[model samples]
Target chain A: MTDATPSALSPLAIDVRGARYVYPTGNVTALGGVDLQVKPGEIIGIIGQNGSGKTTLTKLLNGLLKPTAGTVIVDGVDTAKKSVQEMAPHVGYVFQNPNHQLFARTVQMELEFGPRNIGLSEEEIAVRVAEAVEFFGLQDYIEEHPYRVSFPIRKLVGIASIVAMRPPILILDEPSTGQDHNTTHVINGLMRRLRDQGTTVVCVSHDMPLLADVVERVIVMKSTEIIADASPREVFADKTLMARTNLQAPQVTEIALQTVVPLGGPVALTPAELAADIAMRTGRPAAARTDAVG
Target chain B: MSMQAALPVAMIPGNSIIHRINPIAKLVWVVGYVVLAFSTQNIVVLYSMALFALLLAPIAGITKPLLKGALILVPVGSSLLALQIIAPAVERPWTPVGEIGPLTLYGDGIYYGFVLLGRIVASLLLALVMVMTTHPSDLFTSLSKLKVPYTLNFMLAMTLQLIPVFQREVGIIMSAQKSRGMKGKGFSAVLPSFVPVFVGAIERVQQLSISLESRGFGSNGIKTSYRQVRGRPSDWVIGIVGALALGGLSAYSIWRGTWNISSDIVFSPLFVVVTFVISATLFFGVVLFAVFLSLKK
Candidate 1:
């Protein structure tokens, strides 16, 4: 839902009102008048082509980049009035490049860095570090240097490092970039788990299938503005919107739209849904159908 | 691509004696080499030192980078040598090998050129051995152990890590510029592309600062390190011995009134022999320790 119409009962986790960002150096407008809102625990995916202001938008939420116009209220605190360091406890950001965020010598230290920075007690820091290490499957390399790890593992360490901070809202920029299928699957599972635990997850990604599978809402951006914000199913169903944004629906969704639509069957966002739609149209027994698709 | 391939002299993982030697020990060795290079100008002594440093490369598992650095330095060293030999800064009583315009090449200048080449080769090899064996973190940890300021240590580590990143960005910027029909060659041509590259670097730095702050970099609490640098008894022994040897050489040079004896003092053959023996022993001792540790392990 747009930030302008959030109900009073459930306060918005992220509220942006006519938020606009311009690069100071070139006077280039990156975000041209954006308005959006994210409810607490909502898993939202932001998708756009290069230079569509997806990253710049995420930076605004964390106070890394201030909005040139309007306001960004994260967890009821106006981001413009707070320094990035002050907003860190509320909005944890995981940068795309693990190298840029990773400065500690070891994985354990990296995970503890954020928690310790927020002035958590030693006991609390230990609990967070243990949880992150276990969740990210980093037990084996806890003592090893972060840079010595593989690229996929490094990205996981970067995510886990932010996760350990226990910020109510987590923002991941390009989490699936350069990841293999299994790694992306693992990341998707992690994001879902975080959402289930009542942490709001805002992920910016180029992977349509991943966004469709994990995020409940998908926001399509084009030319520095949000063009569509709807449930993944509704967003993927809009052919004109997808074309204008230079995005493609997930393969399964595309197939369902192409083949299943002719048969008057419902659209599927995932392969499993497509399979089930096909089975139902063919009159297969529900018990005989596989439960593999999401 | 592997990270090692991207770096100039990537640390090769191994249990070799050289790797086991404390980073502080390696640092001390580097300091000693610098001191020795500056203390004496005898061609025989300097050449022996360079030869000895090069000889340690294989034992440390860094011969590849060592050879690469040496090959690159050859042309540089030759040019310096040629300059010195062709135009001696000051005339000497030695015989002139050749004359060009108003300048005469002297035998002393040739000897001095060899000494200069030895300094270059020895310094390069010594620094190469240290970096090729030790992790950047370990090096910084050693610096911290020496009581270097934390901020300085952090800056050093970041600088080392950013080298390859900056190189990659430069390549990306050049390609982007070329695709836009921008044409140039060398420094003048590439100068315009630096603006975008610099802008990218500034952005990266801002991101890095935020990342650091989120992790409590400037917090008021005592920060603990997960990777502790352990200085063993062997490290202390090497560090102390290397320090003493370097100190003794400095003292002896000062005592003999030959601390800066480049052209004026008569070349003392005895002092040259003594310097060779001491420096060789010290250098060989480090190599032997690496061998001993590797075999023991």
Candidate 2:
């Protein structure tokens, strides 16, 4: 598919268009005529205040809910037309609660649950379970009741539950919620790991700083529609978009934007990126990482 | 406590004698104990048994919060006591305030109500001890140990596991509703919260279950486990206690006059009320434990 063609025919992870939803009881529309496209192997962050249709949109992506109007395509398959089981091998969804999806009596049962569902043989299930358990560092709690352990460990079980399926795209809704610093770091590390494996990561979270660190592009939703979709640095750079969508720039980004006056000009939103640029102007530091953001 | 709230974690780490015992064992023990308690109108034996059961609270590591869960039955427990004491005769019953209509039928109604009420308390306290001491996972293992189908065991495990998830989702949906001006006047306001929580939970279940299916939950194959349950010495001790408790009850009941001329209450408002309250407590306890563990950070 060409760049000009519709995302449905292409290799995009998520392709949504004109999606509108009004609940059976409510007059207000939860989602109204939304359109978006996210490419494969990309990390996209969804940021919005409460009631901005973030969760609703994710539900559409996973086929958990059918749209009142429009269609959502994940990996070119129409989500609305298929059941979650049919769409599951390509797209994995993690709910906010780690406990809900956990069905096994023990942690090992939790991980094996997904692969077995997707028609993998016994040997294949075993291999995937072993690899995922080791990868997520869930070796110790594999024998305990998931509910008997710490909160982060349960969250890990939830993630491992999804990861065992080995989907091409992973959608984490509010993953950082209720997580501590160490847990967040572990999640951050997991995201990088997933990215290296070429799985598209779509995360919905209110943690602006954390999302900024992991996500390349962010879609800011406000009141049932897309308000801003841009690179994290570029989107955070725009003050007008931030105010309109009720998305606050990271404290550090705001600090840099207000304090730095490089070449007697206003500062950039992502100071870390701008800092390296400034240093490059003077003399590029050999130690600085210069990965591109799109 | 609110219906939707989950209990805190490790408040009951699920490692007690009562917890290790089988649920069937526990259930049978309570039934048997009540029969023993009523073998005679011997208040001494009944009170002593109550005291013994109370001792189990400590041995089972049941918390003050858990005992507080029992406070839910104070009204029913007290009312049942009052009814047993004040009732005229099983052959012909009458109420003090004839117009009030609160006093129930004559015949076997009050007698059965009293017996059932006592049984409920005894059974519930036993259940509480089991839950406080045993992890739901262990309970599941015990079920599988008893040769229950994997399907039934899986459903039970899913229900146990998803309890906290639904509970927290209640909070999330409540907040989301509040933020969206979903506060309706009177009972409708509850519907807004219910809709979100209900719809959210159902949605999550669908999503998660689908994810679970992909993981091979129902296949006819031996699956691996993250946790192991063994028949330790503690389990044997629990088995002994559970067995002896019921056996003694059966013996005592046979010797009692009341056991033969049986008439148990089938339904009462208070009985319904009592059940509603107890089930609610158990539900909250499960969910709360889940939330506490999930949100530990």
Candidate 3:
């Protein structure tokens, strides 16, 4: 994982201070008050239950929503002062549902929509769309109507459409929701690739295994406030925090916490990590250890 | 207001007399109000009809929402009034009232404009009272009791139910488009957002049809409503009396030639002043509300 700390010279990718967002209808307080900072090139996961302000926080970052009370700065720009369209070039947000965004007659056109909207040159738009198409393995359905494609392909189209814009910051709201194993693998690989390219990635999801496997840091939200912000291992290891948030660690981590830790094993977040440690203790190869665990 | 609350009319739960009354009875009153409103051209009687609707607001426990909704109608009513005044249909009794820059204001046109506005307000208010107090299920069951085709009743209820759902979908669609660098403002920007909304709607309708079939909807069988509404004697009394009273008044006014007084009272100073006040309030109220909406955004 990329370092979560920002160097002194680089401005933070996302800086939020005492941010509060109250939905106007019924005065529902979606985000009460919180402070958060995200370093450039960092991969962070926000995990919380419904109405816990995870989505609200991401919305604030892209200027889809302005803080009712505090300030949000995205890449040195104040979100409150900029319209959502102005932030679009800097931050690409992929909503949870693909059906809400997949409108173009073809997947190729869908990828082109964002770059074109931000006034990119035709050649640059073509290059970006082609890159995204190849990276997401969407070439097979590139010329197919977006709505006519399978739902998982449509989800990729939704994400590739934004990724083609080449925003410095990318926010994925529940990228793994309703996704199968293969689709989840694609999303995991995409997040890593984006991080490797020095893009800041913030994902809000309820997929515990995805968060543990992919993110460097995890922010736990409860009752519209951040209850914990730490490394995934640190956050998930806290039994009180897990119980309070009504969240569980990945199954491997839960097993390690219950069985391996009592035997002086290190905290393992992923199955591979646990298998490696088990192999070391057994003085055996990791492949054989993985087989035994399986 | 949030998109979810932008429904044209919605039921507000309450235990008030209006809420407890049979929806069919309330529907009768609605029909009565419409007949009375359209039968009259007397500005005084029309304004009085509007006042009667306003008085029903408190009884229905919807005074606040009704007033808030009325604010939205201001601009619409003013535009209609202005259009009629600019070009009156009555050419014979076109007494010139005054002149503004280039166009002569006709007394008949101004009188007709206010008459139309009053009629709209009265009808709108009565409809609001019925819709706001009666739940959609109750309305459907009541109509079913009247032998309204089950299909028709279901369609009405479904339309009401889908208003909020479609509104929320549109909101999501707009946000999704905006996040992908779509312009946040202008009609051109908004036009493209409708495509996904339409696609989503088609998908939803298809799924709904499948679910309905699976649930045995519209099957040939004896169907029962979860909310059975049996009309009480009081409901019958209210429905008949209310419909008869307004219908009788409308007939009497038509017979006595009191419904049309465009030429006789068109020149009254008090009538002119009242018309001006109502129109000005609507115009300024609409402007202020528009400003408020922009500020909220």
- The sequence of per-residue lDDT tens digits that candidate 3 reaches over residues A207-245 is 999998899999999999999999999998899999999
Question: Which is the winner by lDDT between candidate 2 and candidate 3?
Answer: 3
Please write out the lDDT profile of model 2 over residues A170-256, one tens digit for every residue: 889888889997788789879878877878899999998788778889999999898888888788778899898777888867766
Residue lDDT tens for model 2, B195-290: 446655676889988998998878886544465667766556666775686676557666675354333324354544444445445556656766
Strongest candidate by TM-score:
3
| Candidate 2 CA-lDDT value | 0.67
Which should have the higher DockQ, number 1 or number 2? 2
Clashes of 1: 1
How well does candidate 3 score on lDDT at residue B262? 65
Query: Which digits, one per residue and each the tens of the lDDT, describe model 3 over residues B65-84?
Result: 88877765678787766556
Q: Where does candidate 3 clash, by residue pair? A: none
**What fraction of the native alpha-carbon contacts across the interface, defined at 8 angstroms, is recovered by model 3?**
0.75
DockQ for all candidate structures vs. native: 0.02, 0.03, 0.58
Most lDDT-accurate candidate = 3
Identify the CAPRI category of the predicted complex in candidate 3: medium
Chain B TM-score of candidate 3 stands at 0.87
Q: What tier of docking accuracy does candidate 2 attain?
A: incorrect
TM-score of model 3's chain A, to 2 decimals?
0.93
Error of 2 at B18 (Å): 51
